[model samples]
Target: MTLLELLDYASVFVFALTGALVASRAQLDIVGFAFVAALTATGGGTVRDVILDRNPVFWVAEPGFIAVAVAASAVVFFSAHLLESRLRVLTWLDALALAVAVPAGTGVAMTLGHGAAVVLLMGVATGCLGGLMRDVVCNEVPLVLKQGELYVTAAFAGAAAALVAAQVMPQGAALLVCAAVTLVLRAGSLLFGWQLPVYRSRPPRR
Candidate 1:
């Protein structure tokens, strides 16, 4: 498989794991786990592909993507109970997914000859949208909407890095750098409790 394709599959597995973890936390059944897992695995890439006018969404073009997601759901379904902290696993898995998905999206956009702006946006969408959908479906606060979270910012930084790196390096190297930047920023936030500053509203006039 091509590096980009490999990254896509890896992201699918990681995102599906996070989705299954959410289902586990919600006490959902096996079907719920599979549904959410599949949605989270492919939602972002589907959105990106649609926007880019790429006929036959990535998962549709390669049914193996769906198979991988289903397999991930099954693995989590049978193994989640052994985890001492599902939340922690979900957080890390989400971070890893973001790292992989950002580069995957950026690489596709570049390959399609899109401008840097579109490339960056596609990267961010592919990294964030799936998790957002998962959280909304699970009735949890979506990480992107949470105050002070660096999720989207990290995605932006990674996408920008990939765009810049692609100008001077091979696509594979650029993708690696993108993933590394995203993973470091996200993991650092999780480890150090780093967050953006929240806006303060002025008092209402009397």
Candidate 2:
């Protein structure tokens, strides 16, 4: 399996797990779990493929991705109750998914001979869109747009890191740097409360 494919699978499974957990929290049934899981798992990558005009979208090319998402949903459907803090687990797992996914998108753009701008945008889209879809579908606050969160910023930074590292290293190593930087930034936001400054709309002129 190529690195991009591997990253796709990894991110799909992880993102699916987060989706299932969300479904559980929403008290949804097994079918609902599967639907949400599959959506969250493939949403971002599907968008990436579509935008790049890749003939068959990743999951459409290989249905195994959908199966993997269903399997993840099944696992969480039966076990979500054991965790006292499903939200915490879901957050970290989403962070992991983001990290893996960003590299997948970046690698694809690079392989297709795209410039840095496309590569960077693809990376951010692949990492953030899945979770955004998941949250919106589940009627939860989209973490991507949460106040001052590092989610999108982290993906942008990670993609930038990969672009720079690609000049001095192999594709595989550059992607690893991408994942590491993404995970660290996202984890810091979740664990250490790292935040960006938010806009405050003050009353116009006194």
Candidate 3:
């Protein structure tokens, strides 16, 4: 497969793995695990495709992607006891999936003649929304909404980089640059607790 194609499949698998991991952490049953895994694997890309009017969506068209999601959920369901800590692994997998997906989403959107705003939106959705859904379904606060580190912001930053680089470089180079930026920004946030400001509530009026 070509590099972009490879990255796309890798993103799918990593996302599936992380999704299943989250479900496992929640002590979900087999069907629940599968539901979460499939949702987390395809939710973001489905949203992007729907918005961009892309046909059939990726997972719907690719049976292998569904197989991968099912297999990932199965593994997690049966092997949860083997994991020493699910959260750490899920976080790392999420970072890796975002690095793979941000550029792919932006590049695909731009290739289809989407404007910069649309490209950025697609990239952010592709990079973060699946994990956000996973967290929510697992009864954890979505990371993007938490007063923690800059999660979705990193996706936006990388999408901005891709939007600019695609204007100068070829699609491949732009994808690489965007992916690199996303990886660096996200990993830094995780490692350093680099959070965006959380608005504080005002005091009660008299």
Candidate 4:
């Protein structure tokens, strides 16, 4: 299997796990777990494929992706109760998924011979949109907008790093750089309280 496909599988499994953990927090039924899992696993890739005009969406072309999502959901459904803090686990898993998905999208765009701008955009979209969908559906605040905790910023920087790395390294090595950069930035935010400054409006002067 190609590196891109392997990246997709890794991201799908991790993202689906986060989605099922969210379902557990919501006290959703088993069917709801599956629904959220598939949604979170495929949402970003589906958008990327549609925008890129790929002939078949990734999960549609290979239904094994959905099988992976289902398996993740089933496992989490039964095991989520054992976690003392599902939210914490979900956030870390989401970070890992983001790292994998960003490079997957960047690699796909690079393989298609798109310019740097498209590659960067695809990377951010693929890394952020799935978790955004999962959080919104679960009525949780989307992590991408969670007080500037470096989610989209990490994706952008990672993709940009990959683009730069491609000049001096093989494609696989470039993607590894992408994943490493993404994970480091995200993990810093989660572990060290790293944050981008938020704008605060001044009170109206009379």
Candidate 5:
């Protein structure tokens, strides 16, 4: 299989794992596990595909994606208690998944001859929207909405790096660079609490 395809599947599995983790935390049943897993796994890619005018969507065209998500849900379902902190694992895993998904999305856009703007936007969407959907459905504040977190910024950096590197390297090399940049920045954020500065408005004519 191609590296891009492998990245896609890996993203699906990791995102689905996060979804299942959230479901377990919510005390949801097996059915809910499956539902959340599948939704979080495919939601971002589906949105990206739609925006890019790729018909049939990804999961619809490839049922194996859904199968992978289901398998992830099952794995988490049976093994959640083994982890010391599901929430911490979910956060880190989601970051890793974003590292993969951003390149997958950017590569697709690059292959389609899209401009850098579209490539960057698609990468951020693919990296972030799934987790956003998962958190919203779970009634939790989405990480992207949180102050100071570098989630979307990491995605943008990766996507932009991929697009720039594609001008001088093979697509696979570009994807690797993308994933590396994303992983490093995201891991740094987690490890050292790195964050963007928040905006604070001054009082109006006090």
Candidate 6:
């Protein structure tokens, strides 16, 4: 497989793991776990492909993607307790996912001759939407909606950087740099509790 395709598979694996982790925490059954895992693993990429008008979504073209997700869910189902304390795995995995997915999404868009704006937006959708689905399925406030560290914002920033860098550097190098930037920024946000300020509305007339 090409480097970008490899990165896409890696991102899918991490997303699958994250979905299984959440489902295990919720004490979901096997079917539910697999459902959530598959959704979280492919939802963002599916959306990105649709937005970019890329026919034949990745998972549809490659049944192996779904197989990997299902396998990941099975692994988590049986060994979840062993991974509880390392639940922080999700945060790190999220960082890696952002790194791999945003660049892959942007690369695909660029390859399709899309403008930079469209490419960047595709990258953001690719990186964030799966996690959004996962959070909603788990009944948690989505990270993008919360007063958490710049999640989607960070992904957009990295994607933009990648798209710009592609002008000068080789595709692989540009992708690596952008992914590294994303990983560093996101991991720092998690480690430092970095969060964007929230705007709260006061109650009106009593």
Q: What does candidate 1's lDDT look like per residue over 172-202, in tens digits?
A: 9999999999999888888887778767797
Each prediction's TM-score versus the true structure: 0.95, 0.96, 0.90, 0.96, 0.96, 0.90
Best by TM-score: 4
Q: How accurate is candidate 1 locally (lDDT)?
A: 0.92
Candidate 1, pairs of clashing residues: none
What ordering of candidates by lDDT runs from best to worst? 4, 2, 1, 5, 3, 6
- How does candidate 3 score on lDDT? 0.82
Top candidate, metric lDDT: 4
lDDT of each: 0.92, 0.94, 0.82, 0.95, 0.91, 0.82
lDDT tens digits, residue span 1-206, model 4: 99999999999999999999999989999989999999999999999999999979999899999999999999999998898898899999999999999999999999999999999999999999999999898899898888869899999999999999999999999999999999999999999988788776886578
- Candidate 2 stretches greater than 4 Å from native: 203-206
Candidate 6 per-residue C-alpha lDDT over 1-206 given as tens digits, one digit per residue, 9 for 90 to 100: 98777877988888898888888878899989899889988988999887766778888888999999999989888887786564577667767777788887877887788888888888888888998999897996776555768787778888888887888988878888778777777877888876566556865567
lDDT of 3 at 159: 89
> Could you tell me the lDDT of residue 5 within candidate 6?
78
Question: What clash count does candidate 4 reach?
Answer: 0
By TM-score, the candidates rank as 4, 2, 5, 1, 6, 3
Residue pairs with backbone overlap in model 2: none
Model 1 alpha-carbon drift over 4 Å, by segment: 203-206
Tens-digit per-residue lDDT, 1-206, candidate 3:
66655666777788888888887777778988888888888888888888888898877777787888888889878887897888888888889899888877887798888888888998998888888888887888776665667778888999899878878988888888888989898899899988776666986578
Listed per model in order, the count of residue pairs whose N, CA or C atoms clash below 3 Å is 0, 0, 0, 0, 0, 0
